[model samples]
Target chain A: MARRMLNQDLIEALTDNCAPIRPLPHPAWRALVWFAVSLCYVAIVVAAMGVRPDFVAKISDPQFATELAAAFLTSVVAAAGAFSAGCPARPAWERFAAGFFLLIWMGAFAVGCWRDVDAYGVSGLLSHSDIYCLPTILAISIPAAALILSMVKRGAPIAPFVTIGLAALASTALAEAALRLSFRQDPAVSVCIWQFGSVVLLTGIASLFGRALLHWTRRDALIASFQAHRR
Target chain B: MSELSDTSNDRESRWRALMASAQDGDHAAYRELLSDLFPVLRRFVLRKWPNAHDTEDVVQEILVSIHTVRQTYDRRRPFTPWLMTIAARRVADAARSRYARGANETTVDILPETFDGDGAKSEQETRDDREALRRAMAILPAGQRQAIELIKIQGLSLDEASQVTGKSIGSLKVGIHRAIKAMRQALERNG
Candidate 1:
């Protein structure tokens, strides 16, 4: 009888608190939306920073173009994975969709490194210190990160770390791609070590704060509001 | 087996429709959906956490989680997986928290108590001390007793004691000094 009463009370409170909500669009759709917005923002940042002088020439090079395209796809797919992670009961595979693209991106970098090593021995892989890489990528990725964080918060926090990690990956990969278009860094090794390294580092760091970013705020608010209603 | 699958399918379709209505702010549908989910969630929690002491609480938590993230449910998707996913996640979370709590707790047959300092005295000892003090106070002269009461017992300054007793501060101080010496001697003699 007591259990029944408690259940009744909870049900009444929940029903009273119910409000109409528009369900989230498919994760793929949401990912595309995020991609479009972040891409535009990244483009504006690139334009503002002034495109690298060899941008046209770099795009004409198949290796450079392939790496850039792979990075861009990784960003979009990772965004989708992040969104998929936020939704419960989506196929677990959806959360790993970005991994394939991530490998391709990494593979492109590996090939570039091999080419540089073949051309100029071990010395060709060496470049002057680029202290600006980490901070510049971070600055470019901030808006994209914030936008994805906000979008993902609307979904469940069932896989917070994975969701946040993928979201961070998406933003940072896009940012690195944009950075490449605007900044000239010599040697594929330097690009791999500095620019790509920044993305990996930032993504790992951001993911560590996933539980802090995504939590059951709505449930807490509902409980508080219901208690207030009872009072 | 086919009958069981058919029942599962029916349940899945019904729950999906009910959830869709709940998202549209249909209160009755929401209530009915929660009522239906409660028993299933309870069973899920039990299966996931066989020795759970708070099965109902975990079930309620799952329900609350579902309500919180209702918007995340895609109407096109099968409802059972969505609901079960949340249920399983909540049950796992509950298990984790229980383990963490258990790790932090020390199980003892008897509750451990705080230490009593060596300076602390028994009630009988306290009573004896009070009685001895009373006897000592009784042996003092009237002036000395008044001085001792005002200064020592009442915690008044010499100036305040003098004011209250209509005596000079110096005289009050002398009275207190003599009163203490006399009490100490009296207590020693009694011992």
Candidate 2:
């Protein structure tokens, strides 16, 4: 009888020691979505450049080309880091760097789009048309959508998005101030409204969507934890 | 001597073959290995955990992890320690979970050997013995309790207990000896 009791106790103890099983977030799905978004961005750039057959030869200076390539590579690294925020093990520094680079890339792209229209003398585009602010809007909105989705899926806190949005708005305001001082041109109110409005909209959408996604996925476990505490 | 050495080598080769076959996704071989492992794993967990209700759950989780990460195991390694590593992690996780849930409030009491016979001891004597054992156990250092559990209750050889606890064999034996001696002394005083 004592032996049986000992055996029972042993069995009981072993059972108590069993570990809880936690489901790992699916890595493949995240990787696939990131790859698709990257491909789409590359496709858009290729289309924008019109894929001219003689475009490669037009860049005659190797040194200048090297600098341009280096800049592009840095931008790509930033994009990759932003995309990698979806990984479960992403560190804080990586997320911060990714966010920083993403802001720089968006600003650069917006300025480049505006300048391209002006330099090419494109009619019906932002430069010749009454809608001089359209290029910046498009540039900001497109990347904002992608960045918002990535940030939301990665479960970034509300504060980072808000800070980034405010920073973007402030940077645009600063750039406008600089332009006014240097070129003596009056800053457009429409540009300021568009920049601030886009930041607010993107930040709001990303935080809302990310919170919703986390709530939906972890609802059961969250509810269980609460219930367990009550008991 | 040569024949004995050849036979020993043959046994090792056979064990290696079994391990290789199991690693290659052979269900029969895997089942065979698991059958041999189940008792040892159960014993190891029981000594560490002592809670009946959670043992099966932990064992199932450990088995599932073993299945999932089977590819990561090296065929050349002895399977016992590999399995024990998983078992230890599972046990630690369970302990954490229990602590988080605030379910570790049960009072444990150990009784003297005199209280064992069905009709030999009076009810008062049995209760006293139980109280004495409980006091003795409470007074023991944590390492000594662990040593007693692993060596005496779990029936692990001192060397095996040392391996499980990551203590030197000599230290583990001394710990177990000291714990048992303390418990006996505590019981004698009460008697």
Candidate 3:
């Protein structure tokens, strides 16, 4: 007769195959790391493209600074939220707080954009380089998105959709920041379509991948990985 | 629903230590911790899923989840909440699965886990009882058959078999090896 696997036997298999267990880093720490990595990329982009000629003058504007600061802060807080969502035992306040940062950033962006309006022609607002916002932002945020997803992978987040959504927000926010630094221009309502489009696209793509990634980290798949390695 | 008791707090401290060792790759400690956790998880899951027979399956899922996310357990933090969070998530997942399956399925595929003195057999439960082994042993050499019948089927130790058969331990081992080969040949021929 075949004996059923006792809890002890199963635990042995799990432990035998387990990855060396260092505590998963705190989500905030990971979020900080992701933000730092994205910042480095943004810095490189700014260096390559060169900061706007009137950077000192334009950057000094409180409205522009507020928008930049809000977007950047959204990346940090949203990262923390994304990381936390993957782990259980997250604080009750985290759900609202993550979205809260995104909302504040969005509000700030709106205010800054509104202040920039001077009844300028659409042509003047977009300029040639400004039209590249969609592609440029998408390109810059790709690595940031990958980095954020890696942070989420440090834990097997049960809420993959929400977790990845936050990660996408953090990533696209950094891309927006890079764009603003490299090619500052007067904000236009039409320009935002491309800006927000990056956020939506990244979030959508990541969420699709997030489901599979999180699902793979489930208990059965984990044991399978260890078991396969043994062979 | 009720608050975790002092005893639970005490247990958490002990589990935390075991987990710390397990995280460091001490399989023995990991096994002990899982063994201990099983009963507690069973009690809690059964309490929540009072009449559901798949309580044991959910408990198993929780154990697996804990194993998967063991690295998430912070040494300085209380272990209970971390463990409870996993258990809660798995239990909810089980509930959702059952609810989804309830819509059209007439039968549950994997049965509700039952406690039996001998334990429930797995889906691939074997039919090779001692009688089957004895019949198989009949196809072996005389010495090999004796080794298979007495030492293997009857579960006698090699030393005990040496004493009973007046054979050395070395010879007994050879006989058992020969017996296994002969049985394999017989099975292959039958096939």
TM-scores of the candidates in the order shown: 0.78, 0.28, 0.70
Candidate 1 residues lying further than 4 Å off, grouped into runs, are A1-5, A217-221, A227-231, B110-191
- Backbone clash pairs for candidate 1 read none
Candidate 2 lDDT over residue span A1-231, tens digit each: 012223333323323332333322333343345445544654465455345454455245342233234333333343344333333234346445534544543454445445545665553133222242334434533553444344434432223343233223322222222221222111222332443334434445544444233311111122222333344
The local distance difference test score of each candidate is 0.85, 0.47, 0.72
lDDT of 2: 0.47
Better of 1 and 2 by lDDT: 1
Index of the highest-DockQ prediction: 1
Flag regions of model 2 displaced more than 4 Å: A1-231, B1-20, B50-57, B69-82, B101-191
| Tens digits of lDDT, candidate 3, A35-146 | 8878998899889989888889877877678767878888888888887777777785664465666676567656655555545433434523345666777788888888
lDDT of 1 by residue, B96-185 (tens): 878999999988996545334324667777778889989999999998997776567555555545545668988888888999999999
Please give the DockQ score of every candidate, comma-separated: 0.22, 0.02, 0.18
Error of 3 at B142 (Å): 37
lDDT of 1 by residue, A1-231 (tens): 012236667777788888999999999999999999999998899899999999888898888998899999999999999999999989899999899988888888889888998999998778667868999889889999999999999999999999999999999999999988988885888898888899999999999999878865333334543543464
In TM-score terms, candidate 2 sits at 0.28
The true-versus-predicted C-alpha distance at residue B43 of model 2, in Å, is 3.5
Candidate 3: which pairs clash? A86-A157
